[model samples]
Target: MVVRVFHTATALANTLAADVARALRSNPRLVLGLPAGRTPIPLYDELARLHRAGRADFRRARAFNLDEFVGVTAKHAGSYRAFMRRHFFDRINVPKARVDAPRGGARDVERECARYERAIARAGGIDLQILGLGLNGHVGFNEPASALIARTHRARLSLKTRRANAPLFGDRVSAVPREAISVGMATILEARRVVLIATGESKAAAVHQLVEGPVTTRLPASLLQLHPRAEIWIDRDAASRLRGARAAALRRLRRSRRGRSRGRRAAARARGSR
Candidate 1:
């Protein structure tokens, strides 16, 4: 796991957009796993800008959302599908046929989950996954105590999760669905690369737990520590609790800069002596 702290949300979003653009440039058909939430909105905006400038192409890219609230149709104002379309899909060149989300209102949710999992497998897995840190360290809908290696399934939303999302439903906790269909932890860990973005002081504690806490089911995001290609990008406010980690990263950066400077100086001296 690599942790990068940025001074502002825009900086974090810009860096994330650059990485996504590079991936798409390298593989136009990349299968991307996307998350829905405030943290990723800025990144999506940046990606849209890149697409408009012809710097990034998404015509061949495929996307799958991480989760959707059960009982909500795609047309629902607060549905994750609606959120994605409004913030990203409608703005990019990606074909609508290539975008998919779990069927939140499916009568046979078990079958739907299986089908969605198969769809991802058939698409050759995700090349890159974008994630946001939940206040309680949940990823997708895999709340605390969720099975560490579970696959796609229906999840009963925790009260904290519902409360956190209440504002999206007009501040009515009752308006938020109690269940959701989510890609599980095992599915997310299978992605070729995972990028998690977090901002604001509300995320500080969860960010700390993810970066420095032990790998425990109580903090689901902590399980990313087991992934080989996971990167965490967070704003300064989100990383405020990681004092030691920040200092260490600064020291390593300084050393790298010093090494480069010394190499240049040595090369110049040798040229003059010659």
Candidate 2:
């Protein structure tokens, strides 16, 4: 596990975009697993900028979203599919047919999950999976008690997830669906690479636990620790709770960057003075 701490979300976003661009260049057919939430908004915008500038190409890439709320119409603003379209697909050049997500609002949720899993398999599996961590350490919609489901399937939402996602559905917890379809732990762990994005002090404790704690069912996101290639990118606020030595080292790295920026400015001023 590699932890990179940035001073601000904007810097983190830029860094993530650059890494994504590098991934695309290395593998044009990269199957990207996308996440939806406030955490990745800036990163999506930055990727769109790269696409517009012709620095990145997503036309041949395929995308699969992590999860979607059951019973929510895809046209609804609260739907994860809508969220992905609004933040990413609509802005980038990914082919519409190649981008797939589980069908929400289906009469048979189980069948939909099965079909979605099969589609991913037919497309050659995901190459890189991007994720957003919930404050309670849930990833996708795999809540705390769902350690048993080893394959892709539908899930009943936990109370904590409903509460956390309430704002997305007109700020009413009652309006948030009680269930969702998510790509399972096995699917995410199967990816060639995994990138988890988190921000804000509200996520600090959870981030610390997920990054260093034991891989347990209680902290579902902690399962990433078992992945062979997983990277976590977080801002300083979200990394505040890491242990002493690690936190101190991160601070020193930030300070070093600041010092270099200050030296550059000082040199520019000295030239002007001459």
Please report the candidate that would top lDDT against the real structure.
1
> What digit string (tens of lDDT, one per residue) describes model 1 on residues 15-128?
889988998889999999999988899999999999999999999999999999998989889999999999999999999999999989898988999999999999999999
TM-score for each model: 0.89, 0.94
Reference-based lDDT, each prediction:
0.90, 0.89
- In terms of lDDT, the poorest run of 10 residues in model 2 is 145-154
- Write one digit per residue (lDDT tens) for candidate 2, span 1-274: 8888888889999899988999899999989999998999999999999999998899889999999988987888999999899999999889999899888888998999999889888888889899999988989988888354766788888888898888888889999999899999888999888999899999999998997788898888888999989998898889889977768967897798899999999999999999
Q: After aligning candidate 1 to the native by TM-score, how far in Å is the CA of 262 from where it should be?
A: 26
Best by TM-score: 2
Number of clashing residue pairs in every model? 0, 0
What clash pairs does model 2 have? none
